[model samples]
Target: MARLETAYGPLPTDPGEQSRLFYKIYSAYSDRVGVLDAHGSYLAARDIGIINLILFILLPGFAWWATADVYRAAMYACALFSAYVLTAAAAQVYGVRLVENVLAAASADHD
Candidate 1:
């Protein structure tokens, strides 16, 4: 009988070095994707905000009156919709940085 051994795995790594390298690579990617620029930030912020607003506000309002609230639904709908929209807007604003960062990282890899 013969015994055979095989090794298949990621190579040994230095986590600290790997983290630093990935950070550098991510920065490079961001720059390539145009997220390094102020205009990119502005565009992402505007588009994401508008999308969240429509999805979280105007659309939900109709649903509330049509189904969720049977009495004085319009008022309840407006109130709930407003509350959700404000929170969604805030979160989306905060998320813009992550979006930009990811874009940059992706671009970096493409090169």
Candidate 2:
């Protein structure tokens, strides 16, 4: 039996029969972490999002302070950082959906 550790506690092996809510939450989290496959893709995307978010908060001000062309170069940098954030977010969402689909297929196979 495969066991899943959740925020509440360890999920029952027979998740579908034991607790629907816990199973759903566990499924979502498992997908988010790419536990089944893609290894560290989810973590990589999360890290990218965090780094871009931090840069978005700090870099614009630093750019403005360093150069008088705040409107041009700073704005461009901010836009680029925003793009990175969006891309990371998209990747995470995609990964989660992919995992969910795989889990669903596996569940169907078991049934």
Candidate 3:
């Protein structure tokens, strides 16, 4: 197993542990973004979960039904979903980097 060094100490490289760490960091960052209050966060998470379910599950089924071509429709739907996921991930990463840079600059100015 690998390890990551954080202010608290070293973290295990286990997938579950890594995922929980990531979620904690993400939740903190989201709070900093100020777009979501408690109720807003809950609603946003629920809406996003439903949208993802529809995109990955219902959309493909609908596509297959509409096209009557299981293989082609399913592949196309999967490709589209994959692209959407990648784009969203890239945007999230970019936003986090932007936030980090801004924070670093502000700290440097204070110093």
| Global lDDT scores for all candidate models | 0.53, 0.61, 0.55
lDDT of 2 at 21: 50
Residue-wise lDDT of candidate 1 within 13-99, one digit each (tens)? 698864565465455555553445544555655665567566655655566657876565566656665765665565566456655
Best by TM-score: 2
Q: Which candidate number has the best lDDT?
A: 2
Candidate 1 stretches greater than 4 Å from native: 1-35, 70-111
Could you give candidate 3's per-residue lDDT for residues 22-83 as a string of tens digits? Answer: 55544544544332333354454455545664677667778888889999787978776775
Clashes of 2: 0
Instruction: For candidate 3, list the clashing residue pairs, or say none.
Output: none
Q: What C-alpha lDDT, on a 0 to 100 scale, does residue 65 get in candidate 3?
A: 83
TM-score of 3: 0.45
| Deviation from native of the Cα of residue 67 in model 3, angstroms | 1.5
Model 2 misplaced regions, further than 4 Å: 1-35, 98-102, 105-109
TM-score leaderboard ranking: 2, 3, 1
